[model samples]
Target: MTTTILAIFALVYLGMILGGLPFLQLDRTGVALLGAIALISLDAVSLQDAVAAVHLPTVILLFSFMVVSAQMRLGGFYSWATRGMANLPVSPPWLLGLLILMSGALSAVFSNDIVCLAVAPILAEACIRRQLNPVPFLLGLACAANIGSAATLIGNPQNILIGQTLQLSFAGYLQQAMLPVLLGLAACWAIICWQSRGNWQSSAPLPATPQLRSSDEQALDRWQSLKGLAVAAALLGLFLFSPLPHEQLALTGAGLLLMSRKLHSARMLGLVDWEVLVLFAGLFVVNHALQGTGLPATAVAWLAAQGVQLSEPWTLFGATFVLSNIISNVPAVMLLLPVASHELAGSMLALVSTMAGNLLIVGSIANILVVDAAARHGIQIDWRRHARVGIPVTLATLLICAAIFALRL
Candidate 1:
């Protein structure tokens, strides 16, 4: 049973690193789900244990916010906001700064990946319309969303897990993280602006891509948008001020959004990223099974004797930055959470793992979604194009965060 569990764990994480198994149609989510199933089917874990392994509060909180983001997306709020930013009459550099700030703020409240998915195509179209290069702006959107999501515990999936697992205070985390998040956004803006100085204009005559040329900007329903915003705002207030259980509060907000008379429940629920939810459930089970095997504990003991203390903020920070890039943020956070008992452990893991996503195109889902959105509109932003911005943006944000952590340490 132990051998099977370890084997399955290794294979699943390998799939995560490669984004999928070779010659298989499985994505990272599918890979995780399969590992969980294998563990149960092989009798390595009881069905009850598997179910118990999933942290219900984190899953519920994550699901509730997905529903909230779906409400905003279906009402065309993201599209409306993004288009408005793109159309502002300002210089390209100023326009870029505003885009960074806008996307960053939105990601702090909503799902960063969903924010990028909804905003990217609209941004691509807007850039084309202005005869400006869309690559840097798209990169800016991805980087800003990543950095801004680090500002709040509920900002991104990994942060959500770290906060719930460690029970970090919402307002307390906000206070510690906001400054670094702001400075990271500033650095992102400066880096993109510096790199795209003479290249802001479209270098070639862009072909008439239908997605970019289409006039069907999503119809923004004022009433629905207002309702969603009000619910979200109330939830944020409750998160900061109320002592209510976060999952319960978030679930209630989702229920209210689902009860909408105008937006059918199916549409709102359908927009939810079920794959991500499944991914979380699968990873929880696998990680739990590994913990049951005692190897993780043994490994930590050996590492401690070797002078590599994971509980220290500096070591955890480096491990998180490295592992987040290697196996993605959520899995890395899970692997590190056991030893993350330091006073500042939650904030350290959340901020470092998120900002690390800007280091490469594959580092964050937002980055990948933006690249795919650009591709659909005939604007190709290859790895090279993204790395030019990602590398520097990631380095700057991580540096600022590390410096702040140093002061605390």
Candidate 2:
């Protein structure tokens, strides 16, 4: 049973690293689900044990935050933000700064993927209207969202998992992480601006078009938006002052959002990205079963004997960067989660893995989303084009984060 479980575990994670099983039409989520099903069938884990392995708090917290973000999206909050930011009569550099700041700030509070999903189209249209190159701004949106999500426990899935698993304080993690996040955001802007310098002047006038008005584009319930914002603000405040459980607070906030009249409860709930929740649950059980196999400790010990200690922050950072590019960030986090328990390990793992996404277009789902969205608008952002900026930005930001960690250590 132990050998069978270990074999399944190895194959599952190998699938994760490869982004699917060989020659199979499966994604990471499918691989995870299949692995869990296999474990259950083999009796490596009982149904009850499997149920216990899934972390309900993390799932609830993730679902709740997605609802809050959905409320904001439906309310035209992201559209309002993009238009407002674009209207500023500032130079490209200043505009870039504002984009980074807003993206980071909003992502810290909400899910970064949803932030990108909501903001990217509007940002693209705004850039076209302004006769500015949309590539830099789009890249900035993806990169900033990635960096900003690292600022808070609720900002991204990896951080949420890290926070829930380690029981890290919401406010405390913020205090520890804010400096590096700010520095990383700045690095993102600097790299982008430098790359876009001469090209900004060549931008043609934005073509005029008749389309939906701002009012028409406002798809969300106004009352629901206000309520969601209030709940989110209150949750943040609670994180700062109250000793209440964050998952509980966030779940309450989500419940409040669900009680909206203008938005159908079913539609709002439907937008919660249930597949991602399932992926997390499936991976949790698989990883838990793998942990029981004792391979993690044995692997760690073997590495240590060879002078390749993963517990060291730098070693972990490099490993995370490479693994993230290969497997994508979320699955990379799942693979590394078992061994990442150091005081600053979560922060290191989160920062490096997130930043590493910038190295290649495939390194993060956010980048892929941006590229695909651009293609719908007849724009192409191939890997080479992305890597020109992405590679440097990723390396520079990773170095800055590593420096921050080293200084604190």
Which candidate number maximizes TM-score? Answer: 1
Worst 10 residues of 1 by lDDT: 207-216
lDDT of each: 0.92, 0.83
Candidate 2 regions exceeding 4 Å error are 201-221
Per-residue lDDT of candidate 2, residues 1-409 (tens digit): 8899888888887887777898989988899999999999989999999999999988998999999987887777888888889889999989999999999999999877888877877777777777788889888988898889888988888888888888888878898889988998998999999899888753554444325344225664557678878989999999889988888998998887888767788877866888789889888888889788888889899999999988787788888988888777887887787778678888887777777878887777778778876665545678898888888888888888878888988
Question: How far off is residue 277 in model 2, in Å?
Answer: 0.7
Could you give candidate 1's per-residue lDDT for residues 107-165 as a string of tens digits?
Answer: 99997998998899899888888889888899999999999999998889999999899
TM-score of each: 0.98, 0.93
Q: After superposition, how far is residue 135 of candidate 1 from its true place, in Å?
A: 0.6
